[model samples]
Target chain A: MSAPFTDAQLAAFLTGTLEDETLIDAIEAAINADPALATRAEALASAEPMDASVREAFAPVLDAPVPERLIAAATPRAAEVVDLAAARAAKSAAPLPTPANDTGRSSWRWPQFGAMAASLALGVLIGGPLLKGGGAGAPEGGSLVLASADLTAMLDSAPSGQKTDLAALGEGEVVLTFRNADGLLCRQFLIEGKGGTTSDALACAGGNGTGWQIEAYGRRAAPVGEMKLAGGDAAPAVVAAVDAMIDSDPLTGADEIAELGKK
Target chain B: MNPDDTTRQALIALIPRLRRFARVLTGSIADADDVVQAALEKAMVNLEQYQPGTRLDSWVFRIARNHWVDDRRRAHNRMGHDDIGEMLDLAGDDGVAVVEASAEARMVRAAVDSLPPEQRDVVALVMLEELTYREAADMLGLPIGTVMSRLSRAKAALAKRIAAEGTVQ
Candidate 1:
């Protein structure tokens, strides 16, 4: 008990890192012979500080079979190394980076360009069919005919749920009809281009129907199953736009036909 | 066995220990796997650079620490905060463990988890991993005295917290 060993000395002695053999022997003898030294030495043991609770808390991690994902990561693979933090962030946010939302370049000239629309500056590589111009093509990807007279004509003429193929804009269909804030008639439309490329747009035009401007435009992969556009789902962004602009419950049946018929 | 196969086997054998160590670094079971995966991938990529005859576990431990540190930094830089609560994986196993640890281990884990990252890491390396002071210093790139002080401080803090919790109960 007179062995005057500090906690550090006791720790070092317990770990067998003490260079002084004589002192080590003396401490071991004293610890074995003296109850107090034995108690302090026992507490200084590496496993002692960790205690039984920590052992229980940690033992399952050791006993549980290694997850398959972990085993795959350990094996040296040639590619598909993910950025762990970025992956975690993405996982926290939403769905995996599927080509569904790959058309990140906003073909829409967003009016007022508020916070939600500003999230369109994505680094996703644009893919899918070109915006085939009335001529040959606009570009392979990323560029589309945002606004045009042909689109305006389609907007004025196309009946709801009926597909209208425009010279500039691909096969387009008006899904629903409503009035914009200015009482100008607004039409929500879906256009499908080649290679599974799809655009959902809402446009407002006046009586002459010559001045069609897109109020909201969103690009997403066509939904699974049949490609019907009447009373169907739309991307949240496009839905939000319709929610913001619609001044009345959507026109239905003969009323919608009468509105389009006026043009 | 070929050296490559041998190395792979050794790395595989160390997974459980690595996993245990990772759980200490990240409180959640899932985040620990993320850290472990990133570290192992990095180790495999740089396998030739790993000096043979040296401790494979320690080398991978260093890699794991680096990966976790880099992940935290990237998360902080992107989010403008260091909380990293959202960055961590969902603690599905933790809920089950908490139900199990309702006896007393819950308080122990809470105390351990509450320790600062540096001290907590020290505790993991010394108390859990059972590294000597010199080995931990070498792996962490910290001085031996710093390792000793941190480990000692962590031990004292855990003891104090557990004792205080016992009194309250």
Candidate 2:
């Protein structure tokens, strides 16, 4: 605040970093004598000030309860220890030695080849699955192969309310769900456009499908009770709900086969 | 409790705070969660290397910072520009606390959200968390002068951005 106090001292004072008692008194004394200095000091406090409302906007995240799944996920298990060791050993095998002091290896020359090889390896590792029609990683549990003629006919029918809404859509897809080995429902879908502007959900239990009421007029992912529609055709949200319902055990083969006819 | 169990419990307890820091850093809850999960996994695997008396929160946060920085670098390398615009848009024009926001408040929030990552991170650590310069420097692995310069530039930039928004309003 004082004319003699440097901007550094003033900044330190504004940030609550000035710890010396003598310096604090001198700064205050200088600020009191010159109203302009007081104004300058005050300006420092308000400069780049945080808005109260921005803090309020994020306050909920600061207070929201941590999900149980996240808690379970955070806990380290013996399996992770095993995985970590294996990963470390895999890494150590290369060692990236100090080039052995030019033992027929130019540091600069080898680096370029090494990088090219790594990139090629990465490309192949990622591209191999995509080229195979759908990777094995594609959610497999929720796929319900429906053989019902009535349901198949409805999908291709012109007047069965199955026509996709093009106006309200930018990019969207319909999700299909079915049980998997883990008993969790998985989902897949055909996205119409770039950003899922017109997507369909094929869930049967909770989330966006079951727990919340789906409007009667909105396009549904698959047929429901008393409506014989496609099996394994639901939204990802619906699939999540179905997965949540079957937590511990896989849905039996007979029950899944029966769903194709009833729904 | 076994050391493994104790360490797990402590790490779990830090998740909320880690998430808060991550939200400040990434400006998106989904991104923040991803950062937190990645940081937690790294911390668990490297638990043996962590000194018992040191602050676990700071250690984990360092990992989060590194992970996000690496992600930013990779994204820049691949896309040639930060594609976080989609993430910012995902929260929607109407945030969850709309009832409390007036037109002016909304403008301020938008301005904060629009800040560049470098400036945004300083505000998150120094202003929001109130960390000392030395502590922040250590956390970010930067010199104290570098931290001050970054914070100073950030403040100046925020002033210009806010003034511009006020003029528009």
Candidate 3:
């Protein structure tokens, strides 16, 4: 006998905001009696905000690599500490002669002092030597840069979670594969060369089939007595970079293989 | 470990969620990133004011919401613009599998975007961000009844728009 419920009332009811019990009962009775009203109410209930499609649209961003600037902003001012630790470790390894004039190589025993001098001298030349020559295939400046062809093959065809034989192509091993925040396929790899030096690098698929772009690269600081190789666990810096960019969990083994096969 | 470090770690873990919420609020990727960055800087500056043993996510979300509201006010003053609907489109360059899916997603975003700013904020807080009604009200400094009313209206408006667009069954 009561007037039929309006769409706004029904919506409020669906959200549990409607308070009048008698009116609520009437609306319920009307919904049960009229199939049209029931269908409308069902649709209204299902189309809530943050629906599946909306969430799906954002999946790539959720899995995206966090931007480096954001990471830098969030990271504590501890790089100096890390550098000191590295220097101390380096110093204790070998006995060095004290400096004669208190200005030159004698102060090199202090890692910070030596590093400052080295930086001032090689500030411009630093990034140059770090760059590797094209197709020379040698690890340069402690980190290994993957060749375009090999990097492409690994990103396109290599299954994640399983180590692939990258030895034939280079001195590195593919540790894992994941999708960055932008939905680009990314792989984390470790390369070891002479003198127990190791490097961790993250590469993502370039746009328009340009092959992989190395996003982040860093040397794995060896412990005082032992060198750590890239394995199931990535270096802390590499992990931080990954954490910044990853919006979701890395793909499962089956999912990674299937995704690789798609390309 | 320093308390700041712990809070910083927790904040870092919440970045993805914050980014998603920012995307919804700003309705533009570039704007969302800027808002997030600004909120982060503000939070870091006021880190000492944050109460320990409380929900850091909610705290930071409030900061983000405040920053967004302030940014909108500034934009409104500078541009003398009231057209907030233009930025609602969230379609990205990533290739979705099916065209139909993409269209439906766009429709959903547009529907949410069409709501009035206050209503949209409530929807973003309660529905999209999965905050409880009380939490949303607390974040928005509104009464519980007001939050529910706004949400109801938002849901109704969205349903009507979606139905009218023929994007949903």
Candidate 4:
């Protein structure tokens, strides 16, 4: 027991990577065992807030236009869809849609070829699947990817419409789906552009097992399917994921989403 | 609406973040934007096999990484993939304003730019984007341990670079 935890583990803990309860507990134990480590953790936690100017500087990019070139490259699926301007306007005037609801999903249609291009774009935007040193290898200044197979396996782990929380590695696309116990269809997807960019979306509906596509892009992005889920079974992706991981019994209520996020 | 079209739009919406990530990886906002644009165009062409239930960000990032690597290969320079040798050359590049930076900020930015692409990506994903190691590692397709070590080394290198510049001042 080399003091229970190492500096590297502490750093990972600071970044919220130790999500498992046991790992967290172990980390806590380690910190408690070493006063210096605990102090260091505290200092890091309270470290100066993001330099006000730095945050302000980055804010523009966060709310900036999607770039005309990017807009032109994107194929809109619906005539009624909002453009980048409208999306930015909406984001400014309203609090971004909550994570708890199915508010983000919209609809669109485009040429068949556009779909393939969009899928690649989605892969870059969504980031690659989670794997150990396989898909993409971290280069001198960039990260590496795991093998393609591991990428595929990670893709298979999510429920319908559940976007894998991956970062853009190199370039790869992932399609994900799973039905919830209530029978609703859910799907989330991503495509990477040739320039190495990534994109994503989510959507869901009732337990009818019907397809509620959770993806759409015109000038602005939209999620697929119905706009809401009732009684805590909403976010078809979350519900579906819980359903797939269960050895027995379906998840219900808030617990379902909680468990799913944990995964 | 064609199902694929809908998917494209959703994915496109993620570009701003992707651009931000790219900037971190390439050390230049222009290069990052270009990389992201290229990645997006490529991803759209391969949507059919995309299975539902996968992490979208990671998938896209993988594409971006590939594009970046390809660019590196094309440039005929492959040294320092993980080692932080050169800081970002802030003095170069004619695109994107320096964001009201002080002289020291410019120096810091240059140092960041000089970092090898590997260290650069880890810093961008973990420090700049605030991604979890698991999330960052997943995006990069590396083991969590690899990510940890990379990040550890990156921080040390950044500190050294900053310290070195300070000595010059």
Highest DockQ scorer: 1
- For candidate 1, write residues A40-66 as lDDT tens digits: 765665656354555654665676678
Please, what is the TM-score per model? 0.45, 0.44, 0.46, 0.41
lDDT values, one for every candidate: 0.59, 0.48, 0.57, 0.46
User: By the lDDT metric, which is better: model 1 or model 4?
Assistant: 1
CA RMSD, predictions in order: 20.4, 22.2, 19.8, 19.0
Total clashing pairs in model 3: 12
lDDT of model 3 at residue A134?
Answer: 16
Q: Mind giving the per-residue lDDT tens digits that candidate 4 earns over B1-169?
A: 5667766777787787777677667765556666776777556545664565676666777788788887767673422221111122332323345432334455555556677778777777767666776677668876554554555555555556767876332
Per-model chain B TM-scores are 0.81, 0.75, 0.85, 0.72
Residue lDDT tens for model 1, B30-72:
6677778777766764677788899899999989888778767
> What lDDT tens digits, residue by residue, belong to model 3 across residues A1-263?
22466778877776655667666566666665665765666556544443455466545445555655455445553553354345435444433322222334433332333333432322211122232321011111112223445445666776653444444333556666777767877777765443344556666666556555555545554431231232323444454455445544556578878866654
Ranked candidates, highest TM-score first: 3, 1, 2, 4
**Lowest lDDT 10-mer window, candidate 2 chain A?**
A210-219
Evaluate chain B of model 3: give its TM-score.
0.85
Docking class of 1: incorrect
Q: Can you rank all candidates by lDDT, best first?
A: 1, 3, 2, 4
Provide the interface RMSD of candidate 4 in angstroms, 1 decimal place: 10.4
Best TM-score among the predictions, by candidate number: 3
Candidate 3 lDDT, B1-169, residue by residue in tens? 7998888888777777777777777766555666676677557646777999988989989998898897787553221121222222232333545455556666777676667788878777777676766678688887554565566666667777878987654
Per-residue lDDT tens digits for candidate 2, residues A1-263, read: 24587778878755535667567666655664666775566556533335344454455555566755346445655543344344334333432223233433322322233333533322222222222222111111222232223222332221212334332222222233344433333332222323322233332222232121111011233223332122222332332333333332223345433532333
Off by over 4 Å in 3: A1-54, A57-60, A80-263, B76-99
DockQ of each: 0.14, 0.11, 0.09, 0.10
